[model samples]
Structures are given as structure tokens and as C-alpha cells.
Target chain A: MATIAVIDYGMGNLRSVGKALEHVDARSRILVTDDPATIRRADRVVLPGVGAIRECMAQLRRLELDAVIREVGSNKPFLGVCLGMQALLTTSEENGGMEALGMFPGEVRHFTACFAEAGVPTPGKVPHMGWNQVRQTRAHPLWRGIPDGSWFYFVHSYFVPLLDDAWTAGMTTYGLEFTAVIARENIIATQFHPEKSQTAGLALLANFTRWDGTA
Target chain B: MTLAKRIVPCLDVDQGRVVKGVKFVDIRDAGNPVEIAQRYDRAGADEITFLDITASSDGRETLVQVVEAVASEVFMPLTVGGGIRTPADIRRMLNAGADKVGINTAAIDNPDFVHQAAQRFGSQCIVVAIDAKRVSGADEPSRWEVFTHGGRRPTGIDAVSWAQRMAASGAGEILLTSMDRDGTREGFDISLTRAVSDAVPVPVIASGGVGCLQHLVEGVVGGGADAVLAASIFHFGEHTIAEAKAYMAAQGVVVRLAEDP
Candidate 1:
């Protein structure tokens, strides 16, 4: 029995993520837990969160789940979503800058900069809250069933700007193209909420259940 | 390539029963809220909204169960509205697996509550629903005012200005509903929708008054709405969501087809 643990660090929509996992695969045991021991013991670990990055980091550090996340994230199959995706990076421009888990060499930035950098024409809304097309830049197992330009539900102000092309798995454009999906080694993360997205999202969850964290 | 215009189905659920469309449309057993939600999901509704028009407190709890039941099997974004007063109310809806909560009368009563809720639980989840009535006469300048109590009473607040204020206060999206066109099913008040959509940078979802698929297309093209919401047209089996999208796509509106990813 593959016990998949959804890490609850006092942030993110755990119910949807947990239920989405159960909806995709009923055979696997899904546990939405804050217990580090259970997370470490699970075959696959999912880190999902929402809200501000500063508060997210504060809660993670206060609960002392940061170190455990670092450990499990290295050896096991790790999935980061939304704020959890930003938390995995080195630093974030949110809340006057904050240091993060540093599992990856990247920084999170707000939509203000992206909009300003694009200059004038305001690509879209601040919180890109809708179904937008995500073009897959590279092929991966999670992208196996989902099409290249599948529409995913996104509602966020901050995003990880594309730095290294190798790390980018999927890219989406609002006014400018930004990193929508990032992956390296056994880790995968998405700015869009797969659990909330309709069919393609369910397919991603179903794919994740069967994925062994390989490229 | 672009952020497609969303077609959302709004269901006014009461005591776990879908109550709104039944009153107007001659539908067969329109009580199953989850089944309707699932059908909408199948037809490619970008999101599903359940307006909790429950009069009693116990009925409010039933709305949560309806949301939970639909969310369990159907994988789509859900927004819940009606009688959400405090932080506890907001928390209850979000905990029930609702992706967003629509705050209308409460925001009008206390605009600060919108700010507080957004600050506490990011602006992404907070949506301010505006019920607007055309206050300006035919000869006068085009203007709309905010209305409360199902458009029976007027708050005398400017709808466009209120939408700007709510967006400034941290509302991620604005759900603009036209009271005059609401049950009429003529079409969306395009001028009113354009006013709010231009006033605020946040996405505006045009609601109330969608008789045909062309009305949906007009809601996006003329109204400049990010998304369009309707009840009778879809619930009464007039047209499926897929047909609406196809019509919109044919009208040169960029929409996510049910066939595409």
C-alpha cells in the first residue's frame, strides 16, 4: 500500500488536496498530516499552501516542520503547490523579503514587478484568478496524460520568474510568460492548483499517484 | 494562449436543495444540487457557485454539506455566497471546500470586514458581489447604484465606485449582478459591467440575465467581463455549457472548448 502524505504546515487547502488524491486513486492511503514522522515514512509527500509567503514560513519554522520538509523532500517524491512551491525556493520578495526552505536555487516575485517590467499595457489582473493555458516546455510523467496547452485554474499574485530554462517544465503567459511549473530530480511544483482544475487537474493528480518521481 | 472567458453556473441552494431555477424554469426534480454541479462540470463550466439563500441557521449548515458533497466528486472551483457575515462564516465556507466566498450585504454593511478577511486569508479567496440597479434615467448620464435585499432596497452607493473600493480593500474578484436584468433574462447590463470592469483591475464576473448563448458572448465582448454566470438557461436544459462555449467561440470570443485541454 502506497501511503501518500499531504504535509499540513498550517497553510494551504488540505481537504481538497487530500480528497483529490482519494478521488484519483482509492487504493492508495492518503494522509493529511502535520506529523513529520508520518511524512517521512510515506512513499510520496505533497506540500501545498496558500496566503502570504512571510506567514507561511513563520508557521513552518514555528512548527519545526522546515527541517523535516528538507529531509523528506530530498529522498522521497516531493510535490510543492502554490505557496508551498514558493517556500521551496531560496528567498521571496513577498513581505519585504524572507528566507525560505532553500530546497531550490530560485526566488519568488510578485505580479507587480512582472507587470511593471512588461511596461504599461497591464497584462491582466493582479491575482491571475482564472483558467489560463499552460504550455508545456518539456516532457515529464505528470504531463503524460495532460496536453501541452491545458487550461489550469490559477489564483495567485506571486510567481517564480523563469531563470534557468532547464528547471522550467511548463510556462504560462498573462502579459508576460512566467514559470507555471518547475521540476528537478524527484521534486515537482506548480503555481496553479491542480486539485481545483477540472479534468486536466484530476488527470495530473491521477498521474502523480502513479508517478515514481522520475523524469 | 489567452485567459479564456469562464462560463459559470450559479445555483441558489436552500436546505441542500437547488431552489432558484425551479421557481422560473419548468425543470424535472431540480433539487439535487450535487448532480447539477456534476453535470455542469461535465459540460465544461469553469466554476460552480452555490448561493446559500437559506433563511434559517440550520439551512446554512446544509449549504456547507452541499458544497462538500459536490467538491468531493467533482473537480472544479466552487464559490459560495449568501448570508456570510463574519470571519467564522468565511472560514466555514472555505473549510467546506469552497475555493472562494462571495460577500455582498456584509461588505456593504461594513467595508472593513472585506479588508480584514482579505488580510487574514489572502485576497485570492475574497470576492465582492455587487447587485447593481440602473439609477440614471434614459436622458441622464449612465449610472448604476448598489442594491441590497434582492434589489428591493437601495444602499444609494455608486456600484462602480464600490467595486473600486472593494478591489482596493483586497477583493480578488468582483461579481457584478444586475438587479433590473436579473430575472428578466434579457442579457447582462453591459454598460454596468464595463463600468466596474474598467474601474477595478481585479477580474469581474458578470452575473444575472443570460437568456441565450449570444447573451453570454455579449457579456464578454460588450460587457468586458472576465467570466459570465447564469442559472435558468443551463439548469432548465435550454442549452449545455459546451454549446454555449461553441457559440461564443464561433462569435470570435476566445473560449476554452470542452474538447481542448
Candidate 2:
């Protein structure tokens, strides 16, 4: 059985992530501590978060889990969800000049400018809450069996812009084509909350559990 | 692009137990909230709204536990309402794992509460639930007035204006319920729904009077609501989320269908 360690950082939707993993028959455990040993020993790691990108990075740094996260992402199967995924970027426009986990060479920016340029009526909205579909960019193991144009639960205003096209696994349209999910080597992240996405979400979690930690 | 219609399952809970009744009377015990929530979650509900029907503050504690248990078991957004008065109550519900806290009677008593709660918790966390009843007048027969305190009192506030005010006051969403259409299984009031949806910029969840899948479809497409919230249709197993989504998709609405697991 796969022991999936879900990192909990006093943020959003940790229980749902853990429960979704359990539903997929994964031996899921919620890890609130920043101890490197626990993260190192886990078969897989799931980082789930919701909130401002800078606050999330600050918390991870304060708890000294950033190094451990880097170590785990370098070798093991690491899944970043929502803000957790955004934190993997190099920088975020939120909270004014805060560094991210730097797992991926990308920048997170608010959707206001993008939405305005797209001519959407409501721009600068803090939270984009609802169900939206993701358009797959290319084939990857993370989206192994899932069909293209599959809808996932989304609730965020900021989006990640990957430096390279190879990092974006899927893109979704709210105001414009934004990176909805990403994969690079051993690291996989989704802007959508798979936990709240029901069966498709569970299947995604199951796919992660079945991953052999190989790119 | 037309917005995707949402299928929401509403749980009328009292003292941690889900209660069902005809026209909101003779409440029969259904099941545990946690159990019911998991069932709905598996059934592919877009969202789940738990209305704590009990009036007492003591029931509030049970509601918190229900929210916590459901949050742990069910992997979906949870909106909890009923007896949520102050900003502290909203905070408590959010801290207890509720994604949104719904305010009803409090919003009627003091509309400022909506603005304050929205400012404090962000508009996304504050949902204003409006219960409206059709009132016949000398001028127009289709006049609607806001009802609060579990539909016991009439505030004489126009439902459309109330919805607009709530949105202006920073409410993220509106759960508009038709008191007359509730538990009737007759279908939603398209006029009331359209009025509220047209009045607010935020997402409007049309509640009450859902008998079949078509009603859900019309509630969104015709009624112009973002989501359709129902209780008996889902609680009685009249249709599953997949069936509902398929029906909506057939009707030309963009719905998120659950992939076979």
C-alpha cells in the first residue's frame, strides 16, 4: 500500500485532500509537522493549500519545510494542489515581492490585467469560485487516463505563467488560457482542487498513488 | 460562453440529524449529516449546503460538529446556515471547516451585518440566504417579499432589491429560496429566480421547488441562476448527479459530468 503523506500547514482543505486519498485506497496520513524524516520516509507527498501565495511561502519557510519539500520534489512523487501548486513558482505578484518555493521557473500574477485585456466584465475579483474545465496541453502520466477538457473544481484569482511550455500540462479558460495543471520531472501540481472534484478527483489521486516515482 | 450550471444538494439538519418533512412540517429523521454528506459527495454534487433548521443556540454547537464531520468525510465545498448571527459565528463556522457561512435573519435585522461580515471574512466566505414568498397586492399579483426566521416573519423587503443590496454589501453569493415553492415539488418560480439573478452580480443559487432534472436545468438556463439547489429530489434518490448532469448536457447546458470511477 502506498503511504501518502499530506502536508498540512494550517491552511485550506487538508481534510478533503486526505479523505480523497483514502477514498482511492491510499494509506493517507496528514503531516502537520515540518520534520524532514517523516517527509523523507513517505512513499509520496501531497502538499495542499489555499490562501495568498506569499503567506503560504512564508509559512513554509517559517516552519523550515521548504528545503524538505525541495528534497522530496527532487526524487519522490510530489503533488502540489491549488496554492500549494502556485507556491512552486519562482515569484508571485501577491503580497508585493515575495519569493516562492522556486521548484518551477514561473511567476504568479493576478488575473485582473489578463481579464481586462480579455474584455471580461468583472475584473480584479479576489476569488474565482466555481467549476471550470481544464484543456490538456500534452500527454503525461499525471493525466494518464483522464480525458481532455475534463472539468475540475477551481477557486482562485491568481494564475501561474510557466517560463517554458514544457511545464504546463493543462490550461483552463476563465478570462484567458491559464495554467490549470503542471508537471515537471517528479513534480506535479494542479491549480484545481482535485479533492473537491469528486470521482475524477479520486482517480487523479489514485493515479498519483500508483506513480512509480519515475518521470 | 454560457456559465456552467451547478447541481447542489441541500441538507436540512437539526441537532446533527438530517430532517425531512413535507412543506417543512412533521419532520422525519433522515440520517446522520456526515453519512448523508458522504453519500452526496460520492453522488457528484457540485456543492452541499447544510441548513441548520433548529432555532436554538444549542443546535448551533451540533451544527458545528456536523460541519466538521462532513468536512472531514466529504470532499466538497460546504455552506452552513441557520442561526448564524454575528461575525464571530461566521468565523466559527469557517474555522470549523465550512467554506461559506450563510446569514439570513441577521441580515434582515441588521443589513450592516452582511457588509461587516463580508469585509472581515472576504465576500467569498459570506453567503446571504434569502427566503421570499409571493404576495398578492392591489397593483401586482407577483410581488415578492423577503421572509426570515425560518419563514416565520415577513420583512416586507423586496426580494430583488434585497438581493441587490446584499450584493452591494459584499455578499459573495445568494441562496434564494422560495418559501411557497419549498417542499412542493412543483418546480422553481422562474420569475422570482430571474429577478434575483438579474439583480445580483454574484452567483445566485436558486433553491426550492425542484422536482426533476428539467427543473434543475430550467432553474439555471431559463431562470438565469448559477446553481440549482434541491433537497427532496436528491434526498429521495429521484436522480443522481450523473443523471442530472447528463440531462443538463442534453439540454445544452455546460455541466461537469463525473467520470466513471
* Predicted candidate 1 versus true structure: per-residue lDDT over A77-151, tens digit per residue: 888888888898899998899999998787888887768877848567778888899999999999988888999
Candidate 2's TM-score on the B chain:
0.95
Error of 1 at A6 (Å): 0.8
Identify the runs in model 1 with alpha carbons over 4 angstroms from their true place.
A120-122, B21-29
Among incorrect, acceptable, medium and high, the docking class of model 1 is: medium
**What is every candidate's alpha-carbon RMSD to the true fold?**
1.8, 3.8
Q: Which ten residues in a row have the lowest lDDT in candidate 2 chain B?
A: B1-10
List clash counts for every candidate, in order.
0, 0
lDDT of 2 by residue, A1-215 (tens): 44677776656546667766776763555454456688788888988877556567767888788998998999889999988898988888876767898888768887766676679774422356678877778887778778777767877767886447788788877656678888888888999888877666767888898887665
C-alpha TM-scores of all predictions: 0.97, 0.84
Best by lDDT: 1
**lDDT for residue A77 in candidate 2, whole number 0-100:** 91
